[model samples]
Target: MSRTPSFEPYEGPAGGWGSARSLGNILRREGVPASGTLVLGRQNKVDGFQCVSCAWVKPAKPLPFEFCENGAKATAWEITSHRCEPAFFAKHTVSELLGWDDYHLEQVGRLTHPMRYDAASDKYVPVSWGKAVREIGQTLRALPDRRNVVFYSSGRTSNEASYLYGLFARLYGNNNLPDSSNMCHETTSVALPPAIGVPVGTVALDDFAKTDCILFFGQNPGSNSPRMLHPMQEAAERGVPIIAYNPLRERGLERFTNPQSPTEMLTHHETKLASQYHQVKAGGDLAALTGICLAVLEMEDHAKQARLPPVLDHDFIDTHTHGFGDFLGWLRTQGWAELERRSGLSRSAMTATAEVYARSKATIGIYGMGLTQHRAGVETVQMLVNLLLMRGNIGRDGAGICPVRGHSNVQGQRTVGITEKPELVPMDRLAKQYGFEPPRETGLNTVEACEKILAREVPAFIMLGGNFVRAIPDRGQMEPAWREIGLTVNIATKLNRSQLVPGRISYILPVLGRIEQDVQNGPQSTSMEDSTGCIHGSRGVRKPASPHLISETRLVCEIAEATLESNPLTPWKDWASDYRLIRKSIGETYPEIFFDYDQRMWEPGGFQRPLPARHREWKTENGKANFITPKGLAEDKDMPEPDEDALRLITLRSNDQFNTTVYGYTDRFRGIRGTRDVVLMNRSDIARLGLSEGDRIGLRTASKRDDVRRELGGLTVVPYDIPAGCIGAYYPEANVLLPIWHYAEGSKTPAAKSVPVHVYRGPAAA
Candidate 1:
C-alpha cells in the first residue's frame, strides 16, 4: 500500500513558491481549502489562537501572513473536515489499527466522542461522559499507591489546563507529573539554572533586531521553527554575521526566501542565512564549543601581550560570575588535537568562528535538540553558556542563550508546575492555597516512568495530550510494557499510536483543539508562554469539530472532581466554569511571577515573565552566575570509542513532520519523497561500508550490552553532506534502535541524537 520513494537533489530555496505550493496541497488534501486560509490569517494575532506548532515568539507588530507552511499544516490538520466517530472505531479493531502507520492513524481525522476499549470485541465503543468519568475515577482511586500512576503532559495543553492537571496530581497524592520537556529541552532546564540562574532563554524577540552576530549550534530553524527564518533573514539583510554548526548543513540555515515577501517571491531572490557553516560531527557540540572558547582565550592572551583591547569581559566576570579562574585553567589544559578529532572540524574553522564571536559586540547563541538530546547534553549546554560568558553575552540587549523549544507551550507547562520534581515548584504555597498536603517526594520522568511500567510497578497512565507510545524512545520495549498497565486514559484531539495501544481499562476522551471555540461560562481565552519567556493569550475563533468534544480545562476538572472526594476549598467546578478563577489561583500560588496574569494578558504585547538573569541578578545559591567546567573534551566520557565498523546515528525530523506527527511522506528540504524509511549517509562512509547509493542497508545497535539486540533493516542508502562518521534517519522509526537507559547524565533526557550503530548490506538479524 505504500508508494516507493524517489530521491533527487532539491535545488530550491526554502519558503518561496515551494512552501506556498506545499501549503496549498496540504490545505486541499485536508479538506479545508478556503476555510484553512481564513483560519491561518487569524493565527498569532492579538485575538487569534496561537499557532499550534513551534514556540517561536510572535512579533509585537503583526504582519498579514504571520503563519508559516508548517503552521498552516498544523491548523489544517486540526480543523480538517474528516471525522473519526464511534462508527469508524467500531468497524476497526485495535489490532487492525496498530498495523497502520502514524500518518494514516492521524489522517483518519479528529476524534468525535469518548470511546472505551472493549476487550471482548477488540474494538472501541461509544461511552457516555458520565459513565466513563465515574469508572475511570473509581479505578484510579482503587490503585494500591498514588505513586503507581503516571500523569504525562504535552506542550500543546494551555496554561490553565496544565495548572489544573498539576493540581489534580498533587491533590491525588504524588508528583508523578512528567511532560514533553523530559524528552526535548530538559537539558536546557537542567544546565541553565546553575550557569545563568534561569531555566529559560534570556533574550526577547526584539533582541534579534539589535544583535551584532547570531551563532547557531545544532539547530535548523527552516524546518523546526520556520517563523524563526524571518528574523534570521532580517539579520542577514542587515549584514549581521550568522555562524552555524551542525552535523547536517540544513537548508533553512543555508538560504531562505520569505513567503510573505512579495519582492522576494516575484524576483525569485533568496537570502543567504549562515555566513559560515561548520558540519560538526554528531555528539561533537561540547568539543566544538570548547575549541571556540579556547580560541577566544588565546585571542584575549594575545591582546593583553600586545597592549591591544582585551577580548574577554573582565568587568562582568568579576562582578557577576564565579569560578572563572578555575574554568580558565581547566579550559587551557584541553588540547586542540582532541578537540579537532572529536568535533570533526579543523582548528582553522574553530578559530575563524571565535574570531567572528570576538569581533561582535553582542552575540546570540541559539540551539535545539541536537545539543540537548545527547549523553553530554547538559555539559554541552554549559559549554555554550561558557562561550557566551567569555564575551559577556548574557543580560545585555541583543545577547543571550536561546534554546528553541518544540511545542507552543512546552515552556509554559513547566512554568505552571508540570514537573516530576516537587522542589522546583512551590509545594508549600500550593498546599496553603488549596488546603491539602502536597507530596514533596520526586516522581517519575519519561525514562523512569517507562522503566517502572516495564517492571510492572505502574498501574495507571494518564496523558494530557501526546502520542506517548510513539514519541518516547525504545519502542520495542515500551509498546509492549504499555499494554500491561491496569488503566490508560488519553485526553486528545485525534487518534494516535498511543491510543490504539490500550491498557486493560483504557478510555479515549476527545478534547477541543487550540483553533476551536472553548465556551464555558462565556467565550474563554487561555495563555501560553513562548520560548522567549513571553506569556500571551490565545483565543479560538472556529467551531468545534464535534459537539461531543470538551475543553481540556473542563475535562481535567471533571476527572479531578469525580476521582477525589468533594473538597470545597479546591472548587474544581467553579474553576472549570471560569478560567479567570484558575488564573487567580495561579497568580496567588506564584505571586512573584504571575501576580497580574489576567490583566497583563490584554496588554499590547502580553507580559514578559521576570527573568533575573536578564538583569544580571543571579538567583543561584551563591547569588552569582557560575562557570562549571566539564570533565573532558568528550561530551560523553562514559561512552566507549566506537569500533571501526561503527558509525554514530542521529535521528531527525522531516520537514513535513512536527515532533512525532508525520503530515506527509515528503521531506521537501532534504529532497526525500514518498517514504520515511531511508538512511542518509556521507559518501565516504557509504563507500567504506561497501554499499552503493541505492543499497538496502541494515543498522544494528552498537550498545555494549549483549542482552538486548536492536536492529533496523531495509533502509535505502542516500549519500548526504554529513560528517564522514555519521548517518541520519527519521525519528520514531529509528527509536527502536535506541536503548531506554541511554540518556543525558544530569537531565535524564533520552540520548536520541547520538547512538553508535553498525551498517551492513543485508537484512537485520532476527
Candidate 2:
C-alpha cells in the first residue's frame, strides 16, 4: 500500500536485467561481506555452501557466479553485517514489530543474539546459551506428555542438525517431528512410494542434457528454482521438446536467457524453454495429465490396429510394474471429452503432447508444488508417475521424475530422517547404536502439528528455522494456536513473523548462517542434499555477526544433553563436539543411503544418494509399482461449483519472493510494481464480474464450513492471460482465505493452489 501499483509488460525473458536489478537491491540492503568474492564462484559447485534458498542441484563444474539471482540474494542476506542485537529488540516490542510487513521485519537485519522475552518489560534481552537450553529442557521435562512438545525442522537446516534433532526428539520420548517438508512435498513422499519406490525424485542434473523430451508440470523455476532454468535452457538448445502445463504461463517455463552465458548476457539472446505450452485451469493438472495418458493409450491401440510396433513399453510394464491392466480398464471408463473439459485444453493439443512423449526414447517429468498443493496433491503426483511409467522413464539415463523442491535441503532434511513417520530410519540400528528404542508410530506433520497446537495438546512449539506462521494456511486459527503454546524456541538467521507470534515463554536463538564460520566440530562444512539428490559440502566463509551465535547442531545437542540427562547412551556432548560423529551415527543408522558419509562429502562431486527406484525397484506393499486410479481428475470433492461470479483463487509467489521471504513489492514478470496486495484475474473474468483492471476487491471464502470466516480485503485486480473462472494472489497474504481443514487429505499439504472465493467490492476503482 506504500505506492499504487503500476502494470507493464515484462518483455525480456527470465534472467536478464530484471534479475541483475534484484541482485543489486539485495547487496545494497544487506552489505555483502568481503568473503563474497570467495563465495560468488564457489557457492553451488563442489566444496561450496549450497544456496540456502531452493533445492536446485549444483553443476559438476563451477560458474564464475555459480548462484542465480535469488540464490545470490539469499547468500548476501545470510552473510550480511547488519545485526539485530539486544539494542534493536529493546527499541521494537513484539506487538509493535508485529504491525510491520514481512520484508521490513527481515530487513531490520540478522538476529545476532539468543534473546528470551521478558513479559514484564515486553522486550527481549540477551540470555546465555546455557540458560536458554536449561529453560527449554525444563519446559520439556515439565510437559504432561512428550507429545505436548513438537520439534519442527526447516529445509534450510543441515543434515547433521536434522538427524540430531530427530534423534533428540525420539530420545526425549516425543516423535512429533513436524517439518517444512510436510508443507511443500509431503504429497511426493506419500504418493511416490506407492507409485514408484522412492519418495524423492529419481532424476540427476545430467538427465536434462540427455533427455529428448521433458514435461514441466505446474512449476515456475525462474522464481522458485532459478538454477533449474539453466538445464531447461540447455535442453531446449539441444532441440529437445520441453512441454509445460500450468494454469499460469510463468516466464521461467516460457523462455530463459541464461545469464551464465556470456554471449546471451551481452547480446540479449534468449532460449525459448517450453516447446509447447498447455494452460490448464487451476487444479486441472490431474485432468491434463490424464488427457495426455489417454492420448498415449489411444496411440498404442492405433499402433496395434495398424500392425505397427507397440508404442507403449509393454516389456517394462510387464516386468517392473503391476496393475497396468486395471489402469487400462480405468482409463477406458474415462472419456476424452470429459478429460478435455476438465483440463481446459483441446483434444488435439493433448494428442500432440502425447505424441511427443510416445516418440521420445528418453523423457523426464519435472513438477513442483503447483501440482502437489491441491486436495488430491498426492494423487496428482502419482498421476505424473503413472505417465512416466507407461513409457518406462524410470531407471534410465536422461529419463526420470524430478520434483523441483523449494528450500536448500528440504529433501535432504527428509533423507536425514527428519520426517515424523518412519521411512528408511532404521529403528533397530538406532536402538543398537544409541541404546534407545525409537518410536515407530506415525507422528505429526506440518498440518497435524498445528492442529494439535490449536487443540492445546501441544504445549511447547520448537522450530529449527522458517516462518511457520506465514507459510501455513488457516492463520485465523494458527496465529492464535502459536500464541497458546507454553514455550516457543526459534533458531533463526533473520527476523520473521513467527518469532513475533510467540508462546507464553519464547526465545529467539540466533545461529550461524550458511556463510558464517561454524567452527564447532573443527573448521568443518555442513552438507545439503539438492533436489536431484546430490549431497555437497557447504563451508561458511564469512565471520559471524555476533560471537554469541551458535550452530543448530550444537544447539540441538545442548538441549538434548540438558533434557535427556537420564539417557546415558545418548552422547549429546560428543556429537556436539564433532559433527563427523553425528554423520557417523547417521551412516550407521542409514548405511544403504548415507554410506561413508564423511568421506563421501570430501570426494569430488560429493555423492549422488542412490535411488533404488532408479533400478526399477518398487518399495510398495506388493514390491511393485502400483497404478492408483482415482474416479476422476477433479481434486476438490468438497468444493462447491463456483457461481458465475465466484473465482478459484490460487496462491502464488512473485518473482521477488520465495516462500514467505519477500525481497520487494514488484512482481516484474506479472508487470506489477510497488505493491504486494494485488490479484491477477483473466480479462474475460474481470469483464464478467464487472471489475475493471486495477479495481479493488475483497475475497470471501465460499465454503460450507461455518467457523471459517477468512477474508483478505483491499486487493487490486489486474486482468492477465489466465483462464476464465480462476484468479491469482500472493501467498501468506492470501493464506488467510484458505481454511485450516482444507488440505490434501492423503498428504495433509495445504491446498493453496485452489480455493473457491466470492469477490466483493473493496474501496472504489482507481
Candidate 3:
C-alpha cells in the first residue's frame, strides 16, 4: 500500500514542484524516468499517438514537450514493465482486490491476458480469445429482446473503434449506446446545437493568440489542461484581459509559471492569468452571466444617448441572428435586485465584467463541468453563447465558445456516433451505406442506463473503456445494481474497480493502449477529434504490454463477427484488417465533414471539421444564430432556501487525480496531502460551526429525495478562499451523499458540483 503523504502550503506556481513530483512518481514506479520520454515527446505530434489526458486543443505548431504531467503519468502507467498475469489473480481473489483502493488495485499492474471469473475458484482464470468471444457471442445471440443489452463507450477509444462500436450496436438492435460524455459534456452537446446548430466548440486553439479578452466561466485550465497554460500565458503577455467567474478562488486561475520558458524556469517568475476574478456563488453562474449580458445592454443604451456608435452588432443581428427583439424585451424585465441576490456579487462587478466584454472586439469564452453539472446546466451553456452572439464573436479571429473537454476524445466519441440518441446521425445514410437497418429510437443515457440496470431491465453491459461505477453518483445503488446484469464485459488497460464488481458472469478483455502499436494492418493509425473540432491521426509508438492484447478496433469487429455468425453482407473482416477501410466507411457516413478521411488526416496540423457557425452561417431551424430568452432565471426562483446551518457543496478533483483515476491522494495545488478524506471550507464557517482547521466532522446532506441517510464522516477541515456558505470535497468520495435523482433537468448529468449539505460536530461514521 502507498504511504500517506504530508501537506504544506503550496505557494509556488502550478508547473514547478508538482510537475516534478508527477514525473518522479513514474520513475518510482518504473525505476527509470528515461524510458517514457521518447513516447511522451511524440504525443499530439504528426506521427504520434494522441495524449490520453484532457482534450485541450493541440497547438498548430507542436511544442518541444507536448506532454504535461498527467499525460506523462498516463504513459508511464500504461507502459510499465510489470504485468498482472493469471497467476497474480490466482493468488488474490476478486473479493480480496475489492478491499483495496483504486490506486492500489491499478498499481498491481496490467492484465496480460483475457480472463473470466471462475465462481467455484473465486478467482479470474485465463481464457483464449476464441473461446471467450464465442461464449459471449452465443449468449448475446440467444437473447430474446436485444434491447436488454447496453454498450458503453469511453473517451479513450479511437474514432475508428468508436464508429464501428456504434454501428455494431445499432445493427444488432438497440441504440442503447451510452458514453463517458453522458456524465461530462452532455450539457454542452445538448445546449449548443439548438442555439448555434452545432454541438462542437467554435474556437480553434489558434484563437487564443488574437482574442481581445477571455471570459472563463467555471473552468480551471492550470490543473485540468496544463498545456493550455502556455497559450494563456501568451495571451496574458499580449495584454488580453481575462475574467474568471467561479464559486471558489481556483489556484490555477490566479497565476501560472510557464515551465517551458527559460527565464521563468531560471528566475522563478510567474505570469498573472485572471485579470479580474469574481467568486460567483454555487449554482449562481446563470444569474451572474445574465447580469453580464444585462450590463452589455445598459452600456449600449448609454452609448446611444451620448450619440456614440452602437455597442451591439447590428449587422450580425440583422444578417445572421434571430430572436433579438424578444431577447431585448426579456432583458428589460429582469430584476437587478434578484440577480444580485442570486449571484452573490454586487452590480458593480457584473457591470465591470460587461464593460470588458463590450469594449473588446473579439472574446473567447471557455468553460468546464462547473457550469454544466447543475440543475439548469443547459441554460447556463446557452446563456454564455447568448452573451457571445450579441457581440458577433462566433466567426472571427480569437473569438468563439470553448468548452474544455475532460477526456482526450470525449468530443471525438460524439463525432463518430457514440451517442444514445442516434437521430443526431442520419439513419437513412447508415442504412444505405452499411446495408443494415439501424435503430432510430433514442436510448438510455448514463443515468438512465444505471436506472435500467437497477430495475433489472438491462441484462448485459459491455464497456469499451472507462471506470463506470466510480464516476457516477449514487454509488451505493450503482454497485449492487451492476451485479444484477446477466453479463459484464470490460475492455481496458489497467485493472479498475468496475471490473471487481461484476454481473452474474463477467469477462475481462485486455486491449492495447493508445501508446501501444497495433499490428493488425502493419502498424495501424487511429484518428481523434480534439476540443477544437480538429481531426488528426494518432499512431501508437510502443509495443503492446503483452502479446495477448488486441486492438479495440479488432476486438469490436471480432465480437460482432462471432455474434452475427460471420455474415457475408457485412465487411467486418475487411474493415478490421485495414483501418483505412473503416475510415472510408466513416467518410461515406458523414460526407460533409469527413470526406476523403484517410488523406485529409495526413495533413501536418490535421484538418478541422467544417463549422457553419465559424463562418457566420447558422444552420439552426430558422437558419440563423439564436438568442435564447428564457422565462427568466429558473434556478433563482426554483432554488430552495437552505437552512441557516446548511452549506452548498461543490465536488472537486485533486490535482494528483483524473476522473475516477487516483494518481495519489495528494492535491499539492490546494496544500492537501496524505489523504482524500478532507473538506475545504472558509475560516468563518469553521468558526461558526465550532470546528477547528483539523477537526474531524460529519457532513449530513440535505436532500429532498430518498429516505436513506446520506452522510460522510471523519473529514478533516482545511481553510480555503471561498464564499462562506459554500464547502468543497473530492468527488466519488462525496458521490455517496448524493441522491440518484439529483441531476440536470434536460441533460440528466449528475449535479456533482452543487449539493446541499450541512456540517456538524458529531460522531464520525467511518
Q: Against the true structure, candidate 3 has what lDDT? A: 0.85
Using lDDT, give the best candidate's number: 1
Better of 1 and 3 by TM-score: 1
Q: Which residue pairs collide, candidate 2?
A: none
- Kindly list the per-residue Cα lDDT of model 3 for residues 176-265, writing each as its tens digit: 988889887899988988799998799988888789999999988767888888888889889999999988777788888776677887
Can you give the lDDT of residue 580 in candidate 1?
96
User: How well does each candidate superpose onto the true structure, as a TM-score?
Assistant: 0.99, 0.97, 0.97
C-alpha local distance difference test of each model: 0.91, 0.84, 0.85
**Top TM-score: which candidate number?**
1
RMSD in order of candidates: 1.1, 1.9, 1.7
> In model 1, which runs have C-alpha deviations exceeding 4 angstroms?
637-639, 763-766
